[model samples]
Target: TEPLEKLMPIDGYEDMPLVPLDIAVEPLVSSISGIHIYAYSAKERCKNPPADDLTIDESASIMLYSMDSKFGNKSLHVILNEILKSADKNKLEPWLLYLKLFLTALSHLPSTRRQVYRGIKLDLSKEYPVGETIVWPGFSSCTTSINFVQSELFLGSAGPRTIFSITCYLGKYIGNHSYYSSENETVIFPPTQFKVIDCLNQGNGLHIIQLQEIQPCFSHLHAPVFSSISKKPSSKLTFNSVVNHNTKWKQRGVTLTKHHSRGPKPDCLYLPYGVYVDDNQTIYIADHGNNRVMAWKYGATSGQLIAGGNGSGFNGSGCETNQLNKPINVVVDRRRNHVFISDSGNMRVVRWPCENGTNGEVII
Candidate 1:
């Protein structure tokens, strides 16, 4: 019943334009055996669509199809998927526009990498081999829970069943926007390629298959790159909100970073209170948690200890000439090849030589 779990086949319709829902789906009215109750009610039903990349009408187009249940009979998901999974490629002509709109809307939703569940009424383990790649041409109907897939409401525990634990990389969860929010629906848009990790027959007419979604070596349908619909520019390095355009943050690969630890080690950084970037792109960090300053040359993995790595000033033995305590800020006096540190815990500013300084000179 969670029709929002459906996505159309986008293989050959890469060049199709994003027309309105009514005009896009008009070609199928005479041919397909279905009905639409929410035709043109996109604005009314989808008052708060998730993303801003697509227009309201564009977002509503997805919402309409997601909730549209053929006047209380067959769902748009079942109908649209039936055509998408069809072997006849010519049948896709009428659905090109709708497919374009559906794919574009799905492309706007944020991607979550986790395992999603899907249930089939029949055992399909024989078709998939270990280490083999498979492509699901149609939209994948999946839920976040295995219990939901096994429940009596969905594919019941009666006949032969195959449960797929799909590790989807770019899966979209549209359950909140669907008519059935409790289904915990998350879907994989087509033509997503998957590699079978393992397939096991668990006896009693039950089977389990582990699938990992992967980028295929070759293009399946030449899906156009929709860079405009993405939430952010594709970059290897993660960025916070409100990125400064003046900085070269959008560079292809990562530059300098510290994540999730304060370190006594050269590579680890914790609670960095200050940073200074030199003209040569070498970065100096006030590793506040470690009571030391670390300097990293451009593209270097680990940092070189600049000052006060022995211990903190307040650690029973008291401040040593070679030690620092709670250093808050740092600046490089490049003219004299010296580093000035605000040694706050010791209540003084200390100047240390960058090239060769075992102990800092109390300059304050």
Candidate 2:
């Protein structure tokens, strides 16, 4: 009842371990109704004078106090009280409490396992799925190949048998339209009974047309022509002199020379597609037939081999710089300072850094 401090410092207690007074009555404070209690005792002799004063109930109460003090039952009592209050407010039945505890422990065990299993299953399915392979469309024949299609110009030649200049429509309508009779027909020179010789773009909308067998032979005529659209003249007798003086043609300063007497004078020459002129006016020709790319300065009559030469198959650098097999096109990326070639036969696009001829890389 009174504070346990008043009961401390017993006589002949020199052998007793010092216990805090506040902890001595902890077991008594925590004692539940009808629970047994005990006292602290260091000796086994019950016949001692202090033992004679100890009642069974008092001794048991003391023992219970010591046990509660040792285990810090005071803090545990606060936690237990809060738990009981929450349970009561929620009307949580004993069976529900047991169920919740069981589920909580079980829930933690397999949730992680289930998630891992699902992830593995999804990964496996993605790794092995059904799909299809596709084949793309491509050119089938070489007969239709037309190389180096230069600008088309109307040529007038002398002679009564000179293939009378006639424009025929193969599709929809069929008829012989004589160039000399059609007023809408574009004529670079007057039809004054003279034959046309050479024609070339003279910048602007004017073209220089040379007349052959014009009495003085080689008379030149500067006539305006409209290439953007085809226009028909209103009269069949008078030639339309309408000229477009604003047209500009890309000037690719490439000149070809017959170096060898070979196949039926190549009607046309094929250069790789996308070949461009650099700012420095360098021309890169993807000569697929020769299996090499030739670089020529603007207006140069000869070119230096920049890539593969007239070889057949694949190899590395130098004279063995591999064959170009059927390289269909060539392009230059000035910004990237690189050149790209469509190696059709190899089914890939090869790239080479500008100015570096032998070293190359493939881009699919």
Candidate 3:
């Protein structure tokens, strides 16, 4: 009895060291490239005649070698086979192919990930978020012979022969000469043409009026142009008077209430083109004349700076947050504590948080 073994030289040289094989009848298998191979066999058994059939171990070894050579030559074939097996289990073929192509073409660089994430976040935000709106109340014309009940209310004709009244809630026609006659008038009073400038709400439903002569200006002018009518002598008359009228009647011929002039004529009187009132009664005026928004605190007679106070020029946001470029109107959202400004010249709207004024959030 002998153990199964193979013999070969130490190297592929002809005169290399030779080793003896333990099993003499075993075949020497060689690859086509002349590389030597070995086969394992069992020793001959005298009693059982060494079972004539090929052993399972020898067959398995040969099959495994064949398979290893085939797979080693075509490595991609095995990979494809594995992928096919997985696809069969998952029932994914066409979709998997598409995904593979997509992944291949997608960004592979690590640096782009941040930019992509930011772009996606921005796109998602735009899909559902509601942006802010800035509104400013622009002064179109001077309303003399009118009364401002509150900062929000006005009672007077906007123009000659056009009597109207405005409250914070709504506006109504007192009487327009084009539509109503004297007999149709609700109250008996002299028919005088005047514009209501400001209104004061007294205890007895009494309101005062500041009247100035009217001078026409360009129809497109959003701010009151003093130069357009300054040359007219009739426009020089300034009357301060109170018009006591019931909610139902037109009252007249009342004595005027004088208000003492405060401060030495403002270095510059900024005629507010737009106004916004916050919860604290702080008035935000888009002073177009000053090219800035002025803040008049609740009890203060003078206005402080809010936004765009450098005499109307476009520049950086340093100390000029939410600078208005020819601002025309302003609206305040008391609920959100935000101010909306219509930067008409810039053709955009800008917003400012009511709590902070330095940084403006541009909504449009």
lDDT of 1 by residue, 221-304 (tens): 455445322232121111112222333444486545545364578887654556677777677777766789889887898889
What is the overall TM-score of model 1 with all chains considered together?
Answer: 0.54
Give the TM-score comparing model 3 with the true structure, all chains together. Answer: 0.26
Put down candidate 3 lDDT per residue, 1-364, tens digits, no spaces.
0011111111111111111111111111211211122212211111121111212222222222222233335422233334333413242232232222111111111111010000010111111212221111111111212322122233222221122232211111112210112211111001112233443333333333222222222221111112111111212112111211222233663211122222222223333344555556565665544555556665565666655544433422332444565554667676787777766544467787655476566677
The C-alpha stretches of model 2 lying farther than 4 A from their native spots are: 1-254, 258-274, 314-321
Of the two candidates 1 and 3, the one with more favorable TM-score, higher being better, is 1
Clashing pairs in 1: 262-270
The alpha-carbon RMSD values of the candidates against the true structure, listed in the order shown, are: 20.6, 52.7, 48.1
Name model 3 segments beyond 4 Å from true. Answer: 1-268, 278-280, 310-322
Could you tell me which 10 consecutive residues in candidate 3 have the lowest summed lDDT? 112-121
Writing each residue's lDDT as its tens digit, candidate 2 over 1-364 gives 0011111111222222111121223233343322212232311211222221332222222223223232244532233223223423232221222222211212222111000000000112111212311110110000111111111322222211111121111111100111112112211111122233434443333333332222322221112222211121111011112212332346772235434221222222332222445666666655544555666675667766665554545322332234465454567787888777766545467787667466567666
Top-TM-score structure, candidate number? 1
What is candidate 1's local distance difference test score? 0.69
Error of 1 at 312 (Å): 79
